[model samples]
Target: MSLKYLKIMEEIKLGLATGSLIAGGKLPSVRRLSQHFSCSKNTVIKAYSELEKEHLIYSVPKSGYYVVAEFQHRTNENEVIDFLSAGPDKNVMPYLEFQHCINQAIEHYKEELFTYSDQQGSYSLRVQLVKHLQNLQVFTQAERLVVVSGSQQALHLLVSMPFPNGKNNILIEQPTYFGFIESLTLHQATAFGIELSMKGIDLDRLEYIFRNNDIKFFYIIPRFHNPLGHCYTNFEKKKIVELAEKYDVYIVEDDFLGDLDPDAKSDPLFSFNPSGRVIYIKSFSKIFLPGLRIAAVVLPSLMNSNFLRYKFSSDFNSSALSQGALEIYLKSGMFTSHLKKIKEVYHTKMQTLVEACDSLLPAHTHFSKPTSGFYLSISLPEHVTAKQIVHMLNEQHIYVDDASRFFLPEYKRDTLLRLSISQVNTNTIKRGIEQLAQCITLIDDRNDDRKNHPIPNNLFLL
Candidate 1:
């Protein structure tokens, strides 16, 4: 009776008012909403029950709850086009299946799952992870693996920790993952940037930086890079690893979306020098449940103890229950099954998005052609800034990410836009791109007109 339930109801109403939740859209799970509201599951359920009573929402058997309203006479303008969300598709998430695994974990482990566990991680889950990574060509032993809350945690700790080389600066790809950029900023670490694009980076420049700069580690997203959707070739991966070894710079390979790679022969940078030179971090957030907050990092055997010390100081251990459930899911072969389904789903979705971009985008605009990944980046016309397009499209409920935050100050570009295909409806991809193309053309034309008919400088004084 805290009346928090009423607040939940009101939030849902607000979502409805703003047209974000949308008619026939599913609401967040009870567990997810509870975490959001910092309340009990019972409180969320009570709120949902009240919403259902008021004909505002309804729950499906085995499935989660959803809004009760339906889009009546829905038109293209009224429909919300979502290309901004980066989470996994809700239409195919193994929610019910994972819930069963969670229950199984609770039943099997009982109260043990609730208590503090090993600082390194649940050993059993590591065993499963060892088997799981083989598919991605990342060969490693569980003994070298330390599970962290997420890849972000691993990157943050690695940024602050001392490397064997005793170097003070870090090397990162220009327009890299925003989280990692934020981590570097917070730690105030001196970072050098190597420009990456659809054509890949300049190897000679990379070698020059490694040789000249006091570099510790080169953080790389070898496959399906965030905000760019650029995947390096195997040749590039091996050469980069060799360069790292030559310059004594360790490589922190964040292969977060490696599982979605369509090319079976493709390998992570870690595969080139798995012994100790390359530290591989694998995250299940994109491929599985983001809420689980589980990611495994394969470290050098010599660094395992130190990493654990850092891990302990950070949070002592990752969620034991999450580890247990993931272990069960992987060991039962359910994870493999889920991967197979999502592989096809994401591949098809990416293809759809790429096709739409190729067909609709303006000639001056260019986009990354990723084989398979959650993200695709568009380089807007030089005359049109990402801010103008983002602001205009947001009014129509079409969402996109401005990629300026992904870059350091010197490398910042106001022309890049990131579109995530993971949560977007495939059927709407064309329309979204069409709207985007129109926006870009409008801005480009306007800019051209201003240049053609310059406002006199004295007009400002008038």
Candidate 2:
């Protein structure tokens, strides 16, 4: 076992030497690396420790290790302008204030946090989340809510396990969260995807799927959907709940970004669920601290046992220290204050992205300025693929996510790209979008050139 870990350390060292992995790169977590390399967790830990001692990596408590940025340059030196972040900028996070909360937990909770707390979670965090969920218009008892590492972890638990209610399959929007698809794929669960455009879901198709398939649940991101950045109207939200009730399918609402833009008047699917069909999960990774990996899953009373059983089997429990810190942070009113500050900052960033794309994009390209979320989708000209757009933008030191990742592999790939306003400042947003516009124009210009100057018939001749 020891020698095997030594080999793993050697493999990583070679990567660093060859410059395959660079400074500021994140090493896979111990569990992930263990699974990938088919090694024991302790073996992976030993390997990581070896690298750490060599000054090749360093660990952050709670968070995983990171490759130390080399002053002795090993990788490409090009500065990257990011327009692909799904979370808020680290600088904007209330690090000092959150650290203050962590200190309070250490000072207050004492050695109690060092032990396994609860399979559900720390009681105080659950109490705080009940209040938080109420603000999102999801009134629920603390008993129903389970504190989790993150919303994705909750999703994995929901889809990756058998249900007592006999939910044999899952349904999602045609362009839903990629993580949902990932979970479904990992569990080999049958997934039926219905088309969901900016106009909202195709109700007829959704009903058809529900009527035909034994859909265990409908996994949805109703507010600020990933990649699409479109939220469901109250009418649409109500309509979905009605369909679920009609077809007897559970609804798993992932409101990961719900805390970012809150409208007291608006309600989630959980709010309209009177029959206990909706399982709502709220992720604080975006609004609060991503490193903490804190989220809450509000499950139906029926699912509590099954969910808890799987959760306990998985990791037993989430980190007690992270939950304690968050409970205190939420209680201190700092979470609300941080949200307000980020909203104002991101509002300007979003507006800047809108102006840049609208004013500079090539003719025939189309995009919608999102009203609430951080992402905006761009529909490139039919002739230009997302790959071509991403490649060109990458050359200009700008990075964006291709919309193809949001779709199932068997489905036809769309000529689309997704831009997020979370990471970049107004200046970087402007510069990145301007470069993106140039790529769009260049692609069209090349296509026009190909049209005007037809290829010779013998061009492919040997």
Candidate 3:
């Protein structure tokens, strides 16, 4: 609609909000309103019709339109106990620190903030990232780094951009980040999933796929992998870099949660060869505020120009104000201190989940404990399905992600639950876990196979 029609709606809304229009109060007739506003009568009719549909007003055939009663069409929802989200908790955000950084950024670069920034990103932020990457075992200068809106954007660019390899096949881990796996199909790209072992993906299988197919790249979350929460060992990282070099393929390493815990044992895939083959992407929104909208991708020297060109065309550049604030925040030395503080909180929450799972979950259930990050993978009995468990859990007001989604449809029957205590408070972990255990027991009790998997009801409480 035109601005004039929009203005009419805004005036009516204002009248309602300011108490000038009471419930059931009559509104001006279409003919009278049109004359008063100097518009067509049809325009007034259209406005009234739209407002009627919105439940803000109602029309009587002869009396004309009248305002409706206060609109409320929602029920009070029950509080949810979440074990699914991997995003940072909002209640404990360092709002003051960020506000200070934003204020400082506006004051220091008042003029620059309004102008268009470099296509790649703010150079000052990229330079600061060089020092930051050093601590993460990656050493790259600003020229090799391109700031992206987030890891999702980097993943899209990598997936869609032309690869020198003859084939468009990409390799990923089975039961990987389902969100990424789902979107890969959008490009009509062929993808192969390598089964993840205790340490990492099977080296023998990875090499076999590389030798057989003209693979473009191997997308991986080597650090704090989602669903599995498994970090590749330094030995595995070296072998991965070596295999990529041998097969002439690229490795897109998503170190989104690397900063959450600086476990020295698991070096990044890029650390093996900074300039060789690894494409490293770091997500700042994970550790910092979610709206930071700043993630840097350190491209292989040969691929730097290609990625920069693609990013330039896609978004022109990421939010410079966010980049500027982050740069100031880092320079203030608060980023490190904030990391230290949240590391402790996340560690404590993780421990609580582990202890609860150990005591409450069934004897046949198996899981892996993560050193850092907010994920744990639980393998349930073959008799149960992740979807069934998720449905039952939801009924109890507990939320978790079904690991079935992380795998391809053919492998979806695999019964696993990817639980993360990232959103739930620490004190609620035991209760939620205990409730889940009861639901599992109830399922067993309803089945004829209850005798085979006998778990005392009191055992979980003990």
CA shift at 458, candidate 1, in angstroms? 3.7
Question: Number of the top candidate by lDDT?
Answer: 1
The deviation in Å at residue 370 for candidate 1 is: 0.6
Per-model TM-score, in order, reads 0.86, 0.81, 0.78
- Ranked candidates (lDDT, high to low): 1, 2, 3
Alpha-carbon local distance difference test for all models: 0.89, 0.81, 0.80
Q: Give the TM-score of candidate 3.
A: 0.78
Clash pairs, model 3 backbone: none
TM-score of candidate 2 versus the correct structure, residues matched by position: 0.81
Lowest-sum lDDT 10-residue window in model 2: 70-79
What TM-score would candidate 1 get against the native?
0.86
lDDT of 2 by residue, 127-201 (tens): 998997887888988898899888989999888876655769888887877887888898888888887776778
Off by over 4 Å in 2: 1-79, 412-414
Model 2: how far is 330 from its true place, Å?
Answer: 1.0
lDDT of 1 by residue, 276-348 (tens): 9999999999999999999999998888888888889999899999999999999999899889988998999
Residue by residue across 188-261, what tens digits does model 3's lDDT show?
A: 77888888844567789899999998789999998778888888878888998999999989888999889876
